[model samples]
Target: MNYRLLWAGAISGLALHLAGLGWDVYRHSRDVTLAQREDVLSLANPSHLMIVAGTAIMAACLLGIAVTWMNERRFGGEGAFGGLLRGAGLPAVGIAAAGSIWLASRADSSGHVHDASHSHGPQQAIVLDLPLARAVGNETAARFVASSGGHTHASAGSFGADAAMGEGSAHHHHAEVPVTAEQLEAAAAFVARLRTAIAPYEDIRRAMADGYLQITQDLPGIAAHFIRLDYRNDGREMDPERPEVLLYTKRLDGTWRLVGAMFLAEGVTEEPPSYFGPLDAWHYHENLCFVGSGVRTVASREQCPGAFTARTPWQLHVWTVPTAGGVFAHDMPEIDPGAFPGAVLPAAQELRAQAR
Candidate 1:
C-alpha cells in the first residue's frame, strides 16, 4: 500500500467532512425551517451526501494503513507499542463508523416523524360559542360606526399614564369607518371561525407543539408574540385557521392565557386583506433591528450593531380578550398584575382628576 497516498486521502477527506458540517450549520442558522424539511441521512441533501462520502474515504484510507502495518508486522516489524497502536486503530475506526451510522438513523427516523406530524395538514375547527362571538362582532361593528366620517377622537390622557410609553407621547389611532351589512356579517363569521380554530391553542404547550415559537418577552400592556415561520411564509393569505402569530399573556397565577391571533400579509408591498372588512387595519413595522432572539425599533440601520434591520410584513391583530382599545386596537391597555382576568391596571388617577 502507498502510505503517502493513504495519508493524503485521509487529510483531504477530513477537510471535506468539516467543510460540509460547517456549511450545514450555516444553512440551518439562516433558515430554521430546513431542520423540519430535511432528513439527517437523506441522500437528496447534498450536504449529507458530502458528509457520507468524506467519512467513507477517510475510513477506507485508515483501513488501508492498518492493513499495511499488519503486513509489515507479519514480515519483520518488532516494535510492541507500534503494533498495539495499529491494532487499536482498526477497531476504533470500526466503532466510529458504526456509531455514526446508528446516530444518523435514529435522528432521521425520530425527527422525520415528529416534524411531519406537526408541520403540515389543515387545521381542525372546534365548537364555537355563539354569544361570545356575537358580542365580539357587535363590538367591532359599533367601533366602526362610531368612528365613521374620518373623525379623530382625542385619547384620554389619564389612560396608560403609569405604563412606560414608547417613542411618541401622542397615541396614534386608526379611524374606523362604517361597513355594509354584508361586510359586518362576513366579519362576524370570520371571528367565529377564528375563535373555534384557535381554541386548541389556549394551552401554550399545545401552541408550542404546533410550531409557535415565542419571539418576544411579556409586555405590561401588550401580549407576547409567538410566531410560526412555516405559516408566515407558506403564501397563504388571511388564514384564520392558520394565523402567522399567536398572542399570549402570562397571568399572576403562572398560567399563560391566549389573548389573540395576529395575521400577516405576504409583504409590505402587498395590499392588506380585507377579511374582516374595515375592522382589520393592517400595520407594518419599519426600521426594526433584530439580533439573536430580541428585536427593537431603531432610528436608522446604523444604530443596529451586530443586528439586521428590515421592515416586517403587514400585520393585524384580532384580540379575543377585552381591551380598552377594542377588538382591532393597535395597543392594549396595561393589565393589573393582581387581577385574575383582563382588568386594566389603574392609570394615574391624579392626572385624570387634574384634567377634570
Candidate 2:
C-alpha cells in the first residue's frame, strides 16, 4: 500500500484541528459575547470534537510512518534491525519530537474548566417594597426556628414547584413594571461594588453570597418580583454541616409572583444577625437550563433536554420572577459584572476595605 496518501491525510487533518483549536483560544482570550465564546470553547477542549480529529490524525501519521519503513526495507536489502535504526534516524526523531510537542501543548492549553470560582460578573440589585424584604426576612427567621431545615426560595416563590396557572392573571390585574433611571444606576453601582469586593474569588461560592436582587413594583398587597438564586455544589469543598445551619423561606402574596429572597446561615432571631447575604439570588439549586421539560441543580443526577452542561466545573443557577403567562423562560446570564458594559474594576484599594 502507498504510505504517501496516509501521510498526506494525517498532516492535513492535524493542521486543520490545530488551527480550529488555536482560533478558539484566541477568541476566548479576547473580550467576546458570552454565547459565542462558550460555543467556541466547547469545540476546542481536549475531550471535544477537535481533539477527536487530532487523535485520528496522529494515529494515521504513526501508521504511515510504520508502513513507509516496512516498504522501504522490504524493497531493499534492509531488515528489522535496519528499520529500527532508520526509525531513530535524525529525520524520524525530529518528526516524532515535533508531534510530541504539539500534542503536549494542545493538552496543556485547556487548563482548568471555567465556572463560578473563575468569574466576576455583575451584581445588579432587585429593589423591592421594604415591607416585603422585612416579611421575607421575618418568615425566613421563623421557618428556621420552627422546622430546623434550610430554605432556598424566598417567601414568594417555590424552587421545585411550577408557577401556578393563575400566573396569567397578572395581565388583567397588574400593569407592567417600568424600568427607572435611578434603579438602573443602583443596579449598575451594586454590581460595580460587588465585582470589586470579591476580586480574586468572585467566581465561586463567594459569588453566590448575598445574591438576592429585588425588582419590585413597590405596591402594597402586590408581589414585589423577587429573583431567586440557585447553585450547584459539585466538585466543591462545601462542608457537610448541621441541618440547623441555614434557613430559607418563600411567601405568598395571594399572587403567584415572588416577593423577596431571605436566607439565614447562622441562628434564628428577631432582627438578629444572619450569615448568608442576599447579594445574589437564593435558590434551592438553580437549573442551568429551564427551557426544556426537566430541571437541574447542584450535582444533578440527570440531564435535561436542550440544556448543555457547561464545559466547566461550575457553580450554576437560574433566576425566576412571575412571568406574564406561566413563568419567565429566560436564560439569566451568570450574575457577574466584570464582563458587563462599563463594569467596575477590582482594584487593590477595594481589597483593603474587604479585609478590614
Candidate 3:
C-alpha cells in the first residue's frame, strides 16, 4: 500500500522524459540552423526525427530507476535483496544510455557530415584548373581548349548571358575531349560498381555510417539543390570506382535523387582517374565562412577568422540527371525543371518553396 514510491517514480520518469525532449528539441534546432545548406536540415527529415523521439523515451526509463532507489531508502527497505536490485539496474541503465548515445551520435554525424560548408584551411588542397588539354598531345589541338579553368559566378542579372556564352565557348571544350576506348572502359566499370554499391536513401544510410561515404557539402545557388558526397574523412584510401562524393539533387517534390558522382584525390601532384583525365572539369572550394543559415565562399583563409577551412578533393561530376551542363560539367545552372521523374516542375517548385 506504499503509494509514495509509485508516485515518486512516476513523477521522476515523466520529468526526465520532458527534460530530455526539451534538450533534444534545442539540439535539433541548433543543428538545423547550422545545417550547411538551406535544404540540408537534419530534423526536417522523418528518419532523423525518429532518433530524437527514441532518445526521450530512454531518458524517462533511466530517471525512473533513480526515484525507485530513493524511495527504498526513505522506507528503510534497503535489505540485501533490495540493494542488489538497485545496483543491478544501474549497469543496465548505463548500457542502454550508451547505446542511445551511439545512435544519437550516428544520426548527427551522418546528416551533418556533409555540411562542410564550414571551412578547412588548405592543408592538403591543390587547386587546379579544369580541361587541362590532357588528350591534346599536340600543341595544335591544345589551342582549341577553353582556358576558363573554373566557375566564375555572374552578377544577379547576368546569369543568362553568362550561361549562354559559356555554352557557346566552353561547351566544346567540356564535351569534345575524345575518350579513348580504354578510358571509356575504365569509366564505365567504375560507374557500374558505384551504381551497384550505393542506392538512393536506404543503402546510402548504411554506407553513411560505414567507411563508404563520410562527408557531404551542399552546392548552394545551383539550379537543383545539389549536395556533394565526400570521402576525405572515411579513414580509407579511395579508388577510382569509389568517388570522393556522390552528387544528389533535391527535386522540388522534396525527394532527393542521384544526379552524378564526383571523383577527387588529395595532394597537389595527384591527378584524377584515367576516366576523368583532362576531359572533365575538376574544381575545389577553398576558404568558406559557415554561418547558422548557410555557407559563404571567401577569398582567402585569412578572410574568415575562426571559420572552418575546407580543402576539397579534386572533383569531376558525372551527371546522370538530364542537366544543361553536359554529363561531365562540374555544375549546371540550366537544369531542366521538368526532367525529374514523377514530379511536375510547377508543383515541385511550389512545394520546395514552402519547404524552404
Candidate 4:
C-alpha cells in the first residue's frame, strides 16, 4: 500500500473540510458583528462558543494523527495486517470528523430556520397618557404601555403643524430600480382602497379584532393622533401597495385617516428595500431593550439590566399623509423630541465609563 499517498489524501480531506467550515462561521459572525456593532455581545458570545468547538475538533484530529504514528512505529508499517489497520483507522477517523462537523453546521442552520418561522416584529406599544420617557422609567407605566388597548383618536387639527412640510423628503432617496410612472400610478390606486376600507377609529377596532392590524406605538404629546401599526408577523410582505404599518391621523371629528405605512423584514441585516426609489432610506433601532414585557429605546442594551438589547431589523416609513420631513421621512413632522427616547452617551474623556 502507498501509505504516504493514503495519509496525504486523509490529511487533505480533513484540512479542506475544516477550512471551509471555519470560513463559513467567520463570515456569518462577521456579518452579525458589522450589523450590530452596538450590541457586540449578542453575537460575540456565540462566536466564542464556536471557537471553542473548533479548537476541540482540531485537537481530536491531532490526537488521531499522533495515535496513527505511534502504532506505525510499534507494529511496523509494512505488513498486510498493519496496513489494513492503519488504513481503516485513519480514514474512519477523518471521515467521521468531517461528517460530524458538517452535521453540526446543518443543525445550526436548522435553528435559524426555526427562528425565522417564529419571527416577531416590533413591540406594539398601546396608547399611553403619560410621557414616553417617563413611561420607560416607571414599571407600572411600562406594563400599561405593554398591555393597554389603543384609545380613542385625537382631532386631525393637531397635525396641521406638519402640513406645510415639503414633499421632497419622502422622494429624496434614490430608487434601487428605476421607478416608472406606471408603478407610481399602481401604488396610488392600492392606497386608495386602504383609504376607503379603513376608517379613522371604528375600522381600526375592527381590523385589530380581525387580526389585520396591531397598534405599535403611541406618539408623544396630548394628541392620540399618531399610532404605528406592525404589519410584520402578520405574514405580510413588504409590498409598497401593502406595507407593514398603516400610519393614521385622527381627524377633529375623531375619525382616523390613513397617512403612511412602514415596510420591513424581521431580524434581517442592513439590506432593507428601496421600495419607492433609491432616495428612500431604511433604518433600524439600535441598542433597543426588549425585556419580556416592553421595548425601550436606549443607548446600549447594557444600559438595561438583564435585558437583551439587539439590533432590530430595518424598517422605512412612507407617508401618504403630509408631514414636515416629507412623507417618507424618518421622523414625524414637528414630533415631540421625547417621542423616541435615546440613551445618554458618556463623555469621551471618561475611559472607564466608555468601556461600558
TM-scores of the models, in the order given: 0.47, 0.26, 0.39, 0.35
Between candidates 2 and 3, name the one with more favorable TM-score. Answer: 3
* Residue-wise C-alpha lDDT for candidate 4, range 1-356, written one tens digit per residue: 34465456556656655665576576556433122112222222354344435545554556566565657585545778776776576668767866765555444211010010112222112212344313122322211111011111222222211223357764332112344544344334444444444444244454345444322232321112222344465566555434555554332222343445666665566456444333344555556554432345666556766455466566655544433333334444332222222112111212235457
Candidate 4, run of 10 with poorest lDDT: 109-118
The number of clashing residue pairs in each candidate reads 0, 35, 9, 12
List, residue by residue over 22-137, the lDDT tens digit for candidate 3.
66566556444223332222455443344444554455554555645555674335687666666665668767876765565555222212223321111111111224322221
- Residue range 1-356, candidate 2, lDDT tens digits: 55677778777878767876686566445423233223222333443456556755766676667657655655334767666555555356556865764565454221112221122221222334433233223322211111011122122322222323456563332222343445434433432333243343322223224442232221121222222233222222211211111111112222122212222223222232212232222212233433322222333426544454432221112112222111111122221111122101112222345579
Residue 250 of model 2 has an lDDT of 18
Model 1: ten consecutive residues of lowest lDDT = 113-122
Model 4 quality (TM-score) = 0.35
Global lDDT of each candidate: 0.58, 0.32, 0.42, 0.40
**lDDT per residue (tens digit) for residues 1-356 in model 1:** 79999999998888888888888888677644345445457655667767877887888887888778776765334577666666676778777886887578456422211110001111111112344446464443323212211112123122211334357675553332345566655656676677888999887778887888766544434466788999977888788789999887653333467878888888666455566455555655667666544455677778887455466666776777655445554444433221323212211222245469
Q: The CA-based lDDT of model 4 is what?
A: 0.40
Alpha-carbon shift of residue 192 in model 3 (angstroms)? 2.3
Per-residue error (Å), model 1, residue 273: 3.3
Candidate 1 vs candidate 3: which has greater lDDT?
Answer: 1
| Candidate 2 residue spans exceeding 4 A from truth | 30-48, 71-318, 321-356
Better of 1 and 2 by TM-score: 1
